[model samples]
Target: MEHIKIGDEAPDFDLPGDGGTRVSLSAHRGKIVVLFFYPKDDTSGCTVEAIDFTALKPDFDAAGAVLVGLSPDGVKSHDKFKKKHALAVDLASDEDKTTLERYGVWVEKSMYGRKYMGVERTTLLIDRDGRIARIWNKVKVPGHAAEVLAAANDIG
Candidate 1:
């Protein structure tokens, strides 16, 4: 798979989302799209990131941007995680890891000398034309939503 870069057209994907809906990147054309890929549902960093995005959903909407959180977990797991956190952002499930791999977020990671395949924390800001405007790799959750929002506002 080719690695995405700034100004490149973002890869389009349609996947199962929370509330039994499907989210397709192409459906959000003519608006900025925020795609945040996390390792797992209900995990520490991921939860904080989701909640932060949820809190800022109004601001993002005002900025004319769409937010989509994605993980390798299934739709049921996404539903549970969203409900458990009272999250407002859309959470998409990439059960087969195809989308994750396409975005180049799935990789071999190591913890305590144990290595395994997992989603790397990542966030992409796509412009109205579906081109990548910015990318945050190995993301640190703190204040990340605000940063992305700032970037979105800047681009707009």
Candidate 2:
């Protein structure tokens, strides 16, 4: 797992996305990129986080930022989740976990004394130059999207 920090160039990825589209970090050059990695699609926390980001999509757009929600879920699941919630943000699928590992969000998690591998609920703000501006790890759903928007606005 790579430990990416502020000022580090974000690892670029091209993955299948909802609506039969492909998402790539490099494709949004010259724009702030918000890449939110969640554990799964349609889960409670993930759903809230996705909706929150979706709600703030216009603000993010006005700030010259592009938002993408990523998980290990397949494109089919992503399509369903987006349609079910009417999400405005793009949802990328890292079915093989390659992108997840590159971002260092895939990890071993313990729940009820059971060990499992899952996403760490991380969000990264990539500057227009492709360098990381901010990173939120172990993200809490409440107000997280707004916080990220503020950060994006700050950097712009």
Candidate 3:
């Protein structure tokens, strides 16, 4: 698995989002993109992260940034989860894990001595030029959204 480094051109990918709309990084060129990847939808940590990001949507927008969360879940799952939480952030479905793999967020995780492949909570900040500005890997959910927001706001 090749992990992308900062300054690399943000990989362009199109995936189905909550409303059956195809979300693509290329489409958002010349715009700051805040892309976060979580292990699953509706889970405790993921829920907190999603809600936090949603709460800061206005601030992100004011800073000219787009926020998107992606997971290895289907569109239907994303729809239910967003509706359940009244989330305003865009959620993309990556059931085939193609985008996740491309971004290098999918990896082996272990719990209680058991190992399994899963999404490693990660976040990437892509500048308006479509190059990666920052990356947060194995993210800690608490205060994460705010941190990312601060970074986005600094994108001048």
Candidate 4:
């Protein structure tokens, strides 16, 4: 799949979210969208990233941006993770990884010399016009959400 670049229109995605809501990228067209694709729910890095984003969600909302985190876990898993962490950001379940592939986050990964397919940690900030404003790949956990929020504030 061709990797989506800055200024490219973000590929639309529709997936089941926590609380039984259907999240669609098109639904957030008029607002800045923060689409973060992570490997899984309730994992260490994923948990920290989600918590950080949730802590800054009100600021993102104030900047007219909606933060959505995506993973291959199902909605039930997402709900449990959210509840466990009291996460404030939205979490979308992408069991098939179609949207992850579209965003170029699904890739081959190796840990302990074992290789497998997984979602690479990535974040895309989309402008109000639905264009990609910024892309972060192989994301580090700390200070990442704040950086993205700053970019979103500038773009939105």
Candidate 5:
């Protein structure tokens, strides 16, 4: 599938999220949505990113945006991570890789000179009208949540 671009309607999906609830893109239609995909839970980079997003929840809320983190991890893993970090934002489990494929973040990766398939840390800021406002692909965790918050603040 072609990657979503700015001005394109963000693809919608309803998937199981932390706390055993389903979260859908359309559910946040009237709000800016920050859809971020990460590789795993509790890993160094992923944990840092998640905590950063959690720390910026109020800023994002003030900017009228909701932060949603996606990963191939199951509900149990999400629960553990959220509980461990006391995360304020929603964490969605995409174990089936369905949503990941639709967004086109799942891809081939290389490490230790070996190739594998994994998620490319990416974030998409969807405007209140459902159009994608910006995309941060191959994300660098440092200061990323703040960057996203700034973008969301500028959308209006």
Candidate 6:
């Protein structure tokens, strides 16, 4: 799949999310949306990223934007992660990886010199018009949510 680019319509997807809700990307239309894709539910990097976003939920909400996290983990795992971290943002389970592939975040990785398929940490900022405003690929977990929020405020 091709990478989602600015000005393109954000692909729609419905996945089982944390808290027993089904989250659809299209449902967030007409609002600024932060779509962050991570590798797993509670790994070090993913956990840090989730916590950061959760901590900034108030700021993001005040800015009239919503944050949604995605990972291949099932809804059960997501529930555990959120409970353990007291995360404020919603997490969606992309167990089938359909949404991840559409955004081009399901990618190759190298760990211990072995190549494998995994989620390449990424974040997409969708504008109020349901169009992609910006994309942060190959993301570094630190300070990423703040950066995304700044961009959302700028583009929203």
TM-score of each: 0.98, 0.99, 0.98, 0.97, 0.98, 0.96
Give the TM-score (vs. native) of candidate 4.
0.97
- Tens digits of per-residue lDDT for model 4 on 1-156? 668889999989889999999999999989999999999898999999999999999899899999899999999999999999999888898898888888888899999999999999999899999999888989999999999989988876
Off by over 4 Å in 1: none
Candidate lDDT values, in order: 0.94, 0.95, 0.93, 0.92, 0.93, 0.90
Tens-place lDDT per residue, model 2, 1-156, is 999999999999999999999999999999999999999999999999999999999999999999999999999999999999999999999999999999899999999999999999999999999999999999999999999999999998
Tens digit per residue, CA lDDT, model 3, 106-147: 899999999999999999999999999999998999999999
Q: Pick the candidate with the highest TM-score.
A: 2
lDDT of 4 at 92: 91
Clashes by residue pair, model 3: none
The lDDT of model 2 is 0.95
Top lDDT prediction, candidate number:
2
**Residue 42, model 4, lDDT:** 89
- Count residue pairs with overlapping backbones in model 1: 0
Per-residue error (Å), model 2, residue 66: 0.4
RMSD in angstroms between candidate 1 and the native structure over all alpha carbons: 0.7
Clashing pairs in 2: none
Candidate 2: segments with Cα more than 4 A from true spot: none
The better candidate by lDDT, 3 or 6, is 3
